[model samples]
Target chain A: MTVTPHELLAQMASTFRHEIGPAVDEPFAKTQAFMAAVILSKLAGQLQAAEADAQAAGDERRAVVAALRARLGSACPARLGDALTDLGHDGSDAAWSRLVGSLYAERDGLGADEFDALLGVVRSALRARLDRALAYAS
Target chain B: MTDAAAPVETRIAGYLAGKLGADDLRLRDVQRIAVGWSHETWLLDASWTADGVQHERGFCVRRDPGNALLREMSDLGVQFDVLRALEATPVPTPRAYFFEPGVDVLGAPFLVMEKVAGVCPSPWGSDGRRFYEAAAGRGVLPGSFTDALVAIHNVDWRAAGLDFLGVPALGTDFAAREIAKWRSLIDATGIQPDPVLTDLICWLEANVPSTDRLVLVHGAYRTGNLLIDDDRVSAVLDWETEVIGDPMYDVAYVLSELNRERTELLSNIVERDAFRRRYEQGTGIEIDDDACRYYQLLYAMRSAAFWMSATGLFASGRNTDLRLARTAWSIPVVLDNAARALGY
Candidate 1:
């Protein structure tokens, strides 16, 4: 049996959007059908982009970690260092969350200028990641 | 006595008959309305006779689906109490009739109240926007909208027994408490914490503003949440997130760009300066732009929490509504906006 998930999803998306949703009479039901189409289409995009997104994410993660490391130098708080490892070893959404928390927690110690400098690096990487997520969502 | 085997209309008719002590009670126009994500609302006309007198009334029923968005936060029973408390107040709300806390009746907990006469056009739709724009030119609804909000903010919470909504301490406790509430919701939804969200939350905490006065704050106040009749706000609806907190919380909601579309008019109805002048005059509270800015970010967090809860409901298979499923995309969208607002 041939397994084509993307084709199946695209078919369902089109069916829901063009056929099922328009055919429905009830307001909520029609909305639900249209929303199903939207979700399915997004899912298709996300599944297709998974590999490329992962590669881009990995490259960005490594760059962000290196930048943060270079900025931190001797000033890297233990909590922040732990957060930095999640970028390399763990590589999860939660890694950046933890890094952000640590950055704010250690802000007083790092002082205003250094904290702002490090945050700029994190923001660039975050923007790129958000852009990728947005590409698949719409 | 009614059973689940009966259709919803029959069961509700039977239940209302018993409640009203009239055996011949009947319901008409028993249609579900798209009111809010947290509840299944039905607007119906119920009629019966007692003591040789005829009676007719429109009823609004809000039913909790158990797995609706922010299920942990919004309680229909509390809403019933809140409505009853507002009956004599300046706030134009539906009179509370009954609160069914058990599942034996409607298959879920629900509240039935007077269905106030109004048109609650959705702010997101073009038709609705045109309705508001026309109403704005006519100029009655704009003033009516501001007056409705003023009444809500100026309501005496303590005297009106609304203190049950909890009171935050004098300082930045309101902001901290709000942050804690939304953060807990985000954690409960089990959405993987995003860096932008974390950054926004951290910024919100560090810049927590002190509130001088605690007034009843309608957490999500805007045009769509209002019900209009004859160019006046006949009823202030969507009473899900009312709180005994800073008035600026609601003010910030009014000032939020999230509520309006491409229109320069705030909420697609009222002029911003006109609203501010009217609101400040009515509430006796100075308009704090800085506090409004702060609460705007807090609202961003709250908005993210809503999308997370909605997507969680769909993902867990607890809800089959595709609208909930579609909101999964909104999480990233809201976070992106929040990140931009935080200068990310």
Candidate 2:
């Protein structure tokens, strides 16, 4: 644990890309080594921001779910409302994912204007989460 | 154990002997070709003496990799059937010889076909772009590219016994079926839920397009999938995704920006106007822009499914290939593209 996983991966990736990859003769094998290096490097980058991204995403999900619950008032489906109410300040990723799926499933049943409004907020947050997830993605 | 020890060249020779019924059957130039993502392709030269006549031919064998990128969707037997059925048609394709169902010979199911002489330029690579550019200036390759696609669209699949690829019943059935097909694949990955991907899927389902005409759709019709010889499309390779669906599906692929590298030409070869004109003239089906837009979005979703399955396979230890691991990075990238297409 002394050498952090990201640091170790970064060193290994550098070795692979600079040392092992150049010496590999076979075209396919060389490409494989290079790709392995790329994956390791990207994983290292992801590790740097992963925790912060997950926290930001969790906060956004909680905020959006809370707002949706308040917007629906008594009209909210008990199944979804109960799930939303159960989310703590720091909601786990799984609960948020399930709530998102439920929202998508129930979107068609809502009035067109309501559906559009809910979708707008959810999609904006979804975009932020995706952007963070793909920050280092090729 | 004994069979595993025996060289694949030896078994291939024996298999060819049985198929050709010739004496002194031999295989030469037995080399593996690393190109396709789904199949283990091998290039070999086969020779045999029949009635004191010497005959030699080049062949390519595509063997299933057991857990290929599109394992659930690809069928080597179906590809062989398609090639065999296309032999009488005008469409350019490799001449398929035999399909081996048993794994004893080569460790997996394989299809043997005549190795069409040609080079397939990679669509995104600089060298490939240069090759296509040089060929485009010559003008023959671009025309051949369109002509080959036209031939596929013009093929009477029902008459050619390709109806086994289920025919969609009514309007929007093709789009709906395609969406469902990729959705099932995404579901199979068991990856964490992606709201963007889920939204894209729902939107595709709700906006399914109506299609009155059905033709053979080469699902991944693009620059890299075509074989070029003498500045002409010698063969349309990669038959794994062929289906009986809308022709515009193929057209939309040519139009997609994913297949080009900083090039304005469709597929980085044919001029956009010329391709549309020639395709319409040959197939007699007008290019529908609205349907094409929808199919392009479907293509984006399909691409996301592919990357998700790829990454999931690597993450779950179903495959150890570095290429599969690399695909994990593309999942979010492709999903973002789909979100943009959905106007997110």
The best candidate by DockQ is 1
**Candidate 1 at A11: error in angstroms?**
4.0
What is candidate 2's lDDT per residue for B170-287, written digit by digit as tens?
6988889999899888889888657677777777877889999999999999988988999999999998788888888999999888888888988988899999999999989999
lDDT of 2 at B177: 90
> A-chain TM-score in candidate 2?
0.83
Model 1 Cα lDDT, one tens digit per residue, B1-344: 46899988888898899899897898888888764476888999989997878999999988898887888888999999999989879999989999999999999999999998889998999999999999999989989999998998888888999888899998899999999989999999987977888889999998999987998888888998888999999998878888888888999989889999879899999999999999889988999999998999899899888988988888888888888888878878888888887787
Using lDDT, give the best candidate's number.
1
Taking the tens digit of each residue's C-alpha lDDT, what string does model 1 give over A1-138?
875787689789999999999999998889889988888888888887888998998998999999889878877899999899877776687888889889999999989998899988999988999999988665
Q: What is the interface RMSD of candidate 1, in Å?
A: 1.4
Cα misplacement distance, residue B304 of candidate 2 (Å): 1.1
